[model samples]
Target: MSVPTVDLLALCTTIKAWGRELGFAELRITDVDLQHAESGLQAWLDAGHHGQMDYMAAHGLKRARPNELVPGTLRVISARMDYLPRDTATDWRARETARLADPAAAVISVYARGRDYHKVLRARLQQLADRIAAEIGEFGYRVFTDSAPVMEVELGNRAGLGWRGKHTLLLSREAGSMFFLGELFIDLPLPVDAPVSTHCGACTACIDICPTQAILGPYRLDARRCISYLTIELKGSIPLELRALIGNRIYGCDDCQTVCPWNKFAQRAVLPDFDARHGLGSADLVTLFGWTEAQFDQIMAGSPIRRIGHERWLRNVAVGLGNALRAAPSEALVAALQTRIDHPSALVREHVLWALAEATERS
Candidate 1:
């Protein structure tokens, strides 16, 4: 039995509609020729800008060649979902600024406080692809969300969803940059979207505001020195020199994104899955430090924070505590450091001891 081929234009239209129905903010498609992007990617890798994330180098040119990584891929459908928390009080950048100064405050990146975006985006993208498959009758496809080896930002830009910002994140006039990106690679040859013009003209807010100077140039990031990369992606002991610059950002940092003037236009997520849970958006360092391993698991389940596990969580919290101690050394801070003095994980205890010494020095 032959499955009649579906019209490519019709399929693209249907996929876009289905994506909207499934809660994606925008959907765009592009052909798989990333020749223009290859040089930038090669340069980034050659400079070791990826830090300890060797997979970026290991994938080599395959990162830019979608069809090579996913055989028979002809079109890539890129989708964006806005993730700003709704019904917030004052500006988030102001809050993050306060957290940086307080030291006793725990600052998790705004994106990681809610449910894991990987799970949220993958499920929605799969459902969108499944709906297309039902109509087209068994098309070859693969869905990806923050998955390895896919040049997602490049694909999103090529698909006309947005242009890559100076910080290397995809940004749109309509969507700003507070969003998650996902991809659906299909064998069907869909019409490609035209790229949009760059709007980050002469804007160095993200570059200048980065505490670690991670944004080396316009659209170039040295992930090795990025706080987000240092705290979350770099699995080993964080380099001692970078620890103080990390400030109170325990899990991930949002300094660059928070300072972007374009982010004022950032949209709130339509899906409830992204709403902040466990009061994480406003949690204090001491409160989070008081959590037992079981409490940590219970509180962080379904959140991206779970991936770092308890040891790293404590290690991060210790850094925040250390900063807090320096900012306002107190008996409470001393007790917290002492409680974790003999923590089971050497990594946790090491950071705690360093934090205690820092607190003592401040006193």
Candidate 2:
């Protein structure tokens, strides 16, 4: 159904206003065309850079073609939500690096330390879409947050949300890259926003700082070597060669964002949903190590950490513990691995054995 010409501009205006009310910091609309990103995506998939993320390749060109994926999708309404906790310690990155240096400290990614964003973002996007339906009557639209084959970052850039940074993350002059992106694909013909100019301009801080050199070059990242993909996405044994490079990052890595100059301007989420939960912001490894499978489920019930499951969580923490043991032998660190020495999960047991050996070698 053709949208009335008179309602086009009004629809965009109302959407942006309602988005702010829903606690999204920024909103922009983009056309369904993503031909430009298609080639790059194909190349990345062809090179097997996505590792075991078969879904990325499975989507094919549907990821770039919005209307094809969602019938009648004429435009994409892109939104960004800032996630930095307002009260996060001043030297957060420094503290994380120090934790890597120390063997006993367990380092969880800053983003996963809080509630899961999938539920938070998906709910908000649905609310935003629902409100739009109220204003414009029932419409054909679908809300997505890190779901399916959506080219979220490309849409964000096309809608003028921000430029894709050298680290392959969306970065905004106003809010940096410490944010989550969601999309609302609608059949209405909304005016698309022009993309902003990139500002990386000779800065390679993220590339130089990546512990695994995941950033192969500006605007290119090999997910196979990324710590985040390694710890959370990859389900098999932690590659021994890259295990040492994983450092103390157990859940995910934010070093690229933490080191980016633009993130200094990253804003805090207007909604408290994104705030740190359960003191995960500064949790001790041994303390996290002691959590039983039941405790892990209970504490991480509504958090993103739960998606990795107890076994993978233990596997990652074991890698961190091994690295820590190598750096500074500690009875406490060894003991933590010992407790899990006979874990039923082979994944966890293998990592624990490796960590114990590392501690013994250090001693």
Candidate 3:
């Protein structure tokens, strides 16, 4: 079961080359030792910073112990894929900021605007695995994007893909934080890469710009207060205290990344799969809230936003529409909220009522 030293080195080199051909921006290998991250993870969990993501606590230390998760795993191949749409304008940051200021805009995070990264990265990673099998004989391996108990950022950090930024995202000097990470947990003992030095310096831009101040400090995030978690992860009531801070963001929040200076170098996707679909990049809250449940399912068929299901989608849009009504008293926004005020899902009904009240209070 042992590979020759020279052959292992050659295989590692070839694997990286194949990864590039498959659209990964960069690929590096790392050993399965995440012992250094275990304490921080435990402390975060103990503080309940993971919010309602019970799955984060479900796997316990197996998240850091890759070998335990997949027995016989020796090395993990961490791959990065930049997700900025290929047609991204040079002033995309300024444009995003403007969208946030426009109360009527529905600011879906840049990442979720296209096809689901889980599907895109998982398929590409599996294809890379298949290629590895074709190169070597049958190899034991499992591929993962964000769908498992794996600590992807830590793995990517250890693999020399990037250092962990203050926002807790893996950041590269070349590609920044606007990228998706996937991994290949394989039995191959490929030569491990060196970890990169941290480059965040004294920058606190990400923390300062968070709408919900979810970041407690550098590298410490309270997911319970995070706008992304509130909209995408939290399943119950949107915390009343934080709803106003949610602004018009209907999906994941990107304030942290948008403000990071490193993202000035964020790369664009080589694959068309990451391109914006259905005018999501420029959509208004009123327009998005007007979509029928059937229309939402059909339009969001291949997108990651669909996973939230139509109920939560409506709930998020209701919050956005409410925020818009408070900011500008838009009749269109109020009318949209009324259409769903009687929706069957109580979650949708509650949010719609709150949205209507937001406008009424302004009167």
Q: Tell me, by TM-score, which candidate is best.
A: 3
In the range 1-363, model 3's lDDT, one tens digit per residue, is: 555334888888898899999999999999999999999999999999998999999999999999999999999999999999999999999999999999989999999999999999999999999988877778889999999999999999999999999999999999989999999999988889999999999999999999898999999999999988998899999999999999999999999999999999999999999999999999988888888889999999999999898899999999999989999997788888889988999999999999999999989
Error of 1 at 36 (Å): 1.7
TM-score of predicted model 1?
A: 0.96
Candidate 1: deviation at residue 309, Å? 0.7
Alpha-carbon lDDT, every model:
0.87, 0.87, 0.93
Candidate 1: Cα lDDT at 294: 98
Regions of candidate 3 where Cα sits further than 4 Å from its true position: 1-6
Candidate 2, residue 147: how far the Cα is off, in Å: 1.2
Listed in order, each prediction's TM-score against the native is 0.96, 0.97, 0.98
Q: What digit string (tens of lDDT, one per residue) describes model 1 on residues 1-363?
A: 233476878877888888899999999999999988899899888888888898888878998999999988988999999887765544766777777676667888989878999999999999987788778788788999988799999999999999999999998998788899999988887888898999999989999999889888888889999999888888778888888888889888888888888887788889888889998878888888989999999888899999888888888888888877877888998897899999888898889988898977866
What order do you get sorting by TM-score, best first?
3, 2, 1
